[model samples]
Target: MNPRFTNKRVLLTGGASGIGRATAERFAAEGARLAIGDIDVTGANAVAAELGGVAFAYDARDPAAAPQLVEQAVAALGGIDILLNVAGIMTWGRFEETSPESWQRTLEINLSGPFYLTQAAIPHLKQCKGNIVSVASAGGMHPVYGTSAYGISKAGVIAMTQSASLEFARFGVRVNAVAPGGVATPMHEKSTAGRGVDPAIFAEAAGRNMPKLTDRQACTPEEVAAAIAYLASNEARFATGTVLVLDGGQVTG
Candidate 1:
């Protein structure tokens, strides 16, 4: 099998589990040297062990820690070629029920974290003419009830991608985003658990809301990982500043 990403150095955040973990495995299987980071040291190390890579315990939302993560990844992998910002938190609540702390934390993790990490990694990425793929959300494009902060944060992510693409294009470093909808990840499960939402009712409502697309089946993490891989691969060399929506065609008819 021809590995598309053979020998590439990839730095990924949120590699402890869920979509991030799946992306790590996908890139590893493509023969990429991975530098995985997450708040969970043990989990990150475990994934790194399986992939024959290095792990760093770093909080993506910490501005000061972001550069350290880039430096450490570069030190371990020799240089950075692909940076995947996947660390994020999801809070579900109506605007009235949302607290200031909740809003700030959501934006800090979802928006500010990727911003800081991307800024920190740009130097190495520029050196390698690398690319960045951010995990955004479908909520960013269409308004969803009871997800004010999450939606706003992801919207900011798309905006950031556009701006970064413009600035980095001259340097041959591409930046893009993937907006996934209702993926069957740990984060999605946590966001729905104990929310007083009947599974059948919610599914029915979602199905009705997305009529033109396939049924309300949640996407798999591997599916999202494939999109990320494409955005970060050489095939997308000319693509930048674009938000690829993977929301089961919810945004379309």
Candidate 2:
């Protein structure tokens, strides 16, 4: 009955779905004060009500909106100690088949969004000596044939985590990423865009990302949420600039 996050304040992005939602629930159960944000205001509000927190409609892809979002979250949370960036997108297709617009949009949501949010949250996070945990992808570490855009964006996330960790550690801020492989979520279901990705191709990609121990299966969003919680906790105080790969041994090979 000991709470790991008693009296802590957290500002979570993408808190309406997937790993983000799971993370928000986990933080709430641990006694943290929470403020959830997402493009889906209705969904965010629903989760916020359940946690006794507030929700804000946020579009992370818009850099100019980050400061405002951070202000709103901080206002709700009373202060910010954790900035969890879990919002992301998957653009599944061949590099040649992908449009420039799609590629840019993917990076904007998956990479730039986190970057801008972090920039705006830093002063607040610095005040509390907080940490950041981003949801990266196994595809970032081990590229999938048709997921070039998504993979690149996640790779950038890894780099950002490391670089930001290095720069922010001096100020007592930790930065890390959780790289999950083929997590079973709504985002995963949307992996196909036009002609649809081939089942064999998808299976092969999963096989490559998940090793024998996983039986080539996707993990639940809750599992990924566990990793994020650990990284954000004092248990990982000495850890920073790290990518915690929850890839089921795929990266090991």
Candidate 3:
């Protein structure tokens, strides 16, 4: 209705649920044409249909899937004007309990996925002078116990955001990332539920991780999506190489 993104072509990974799903809805409401890519084709299709957009099955764990997802999205949307990289996973375990496999999978999804997808989209984005917004985590900023791999991976994403911004500025493509603390998303639910880790424990840790002046509270996916929209909008044209932390002010004082 706002038409902020009227006729703008967008490609989003992890669009099946959580922040990604919320983002798709927000972008659609703002009048953007979308190509939703998710590992879950059923959910992706559902969101895409609801938004009058197309969907693609995307498995960020697979290195090859990045280029293919981009190709499919380009074919469906004509060209990419905005890329939202929200596809990621959580691997919770102590250092001793964490496996090499777990590290690989987490990194592949949370770190490698964004890297490869951004690399693949750079050319298309350069042509359109588009921008990117990635979903990092509060864990990336400060270690969240029991999620070393997830934290490391997300930290990598945060770094990649700034690095890419510097490299792509000359091409007129902006890169930014959001670092959110705990959110009431499926991923958070799955990570905490019946896992022997008390929910309050994370909340407490999240609170302690932030500046003493700040408090901890779980935000909704839609709330995070709103931030992504701003960074990708014309409003943030002068902003780049920035990591926006939306963790109830935990990351900052």
Give lDDT tens digits, candidate 3, residues 52-100. 9999988998889999999998998889999999988877767677789
Q: What lDDT score goes with residue 158 in model 1?
A: 96
Q: Which runs of model 3 end up more than 4 angstroms from their true locations?
A: 194-216
Backbone steric clashes in candidate 3, count: 0
Tens-place lDDT per residue, model 1, 154-201, is 999999999999999989999999998878887778654635544543
What local lDDT does model 3 show for residue 13? 89
- Clash number by candidate, in order: 0, 0, 0
Where does the lowest 10-residue lDDT sum fall in candidate 1? 203-212
TM-score, predicted candidate 3 vs. hidden true structure: 0.92
The C-alpha RMSD of each candidate to the native structure, in angstroms, is 2.5, 2.1, 2.5
Using TM-score as the measure, name the better of candidate 2 and candidate 3: 2
Question: How do all the candidates rank in terms of lDDT, highest first?
Answer: 3, 1, 2
Quote each prediction's TM-score. 0.93, 0.93, 0.92
Q: Report how far residue 212 has shifted in candidate 1, in Å.
A: 4.2
Model 2 ranges off by over 4 Å:
192-207
Q: lDDT of all predictions, in order shown?
A: 0.87, 0.86, 0.87
Position 135, candidate 2: lDDT:
90
Cα lDDT of model 2 overall?
0.86
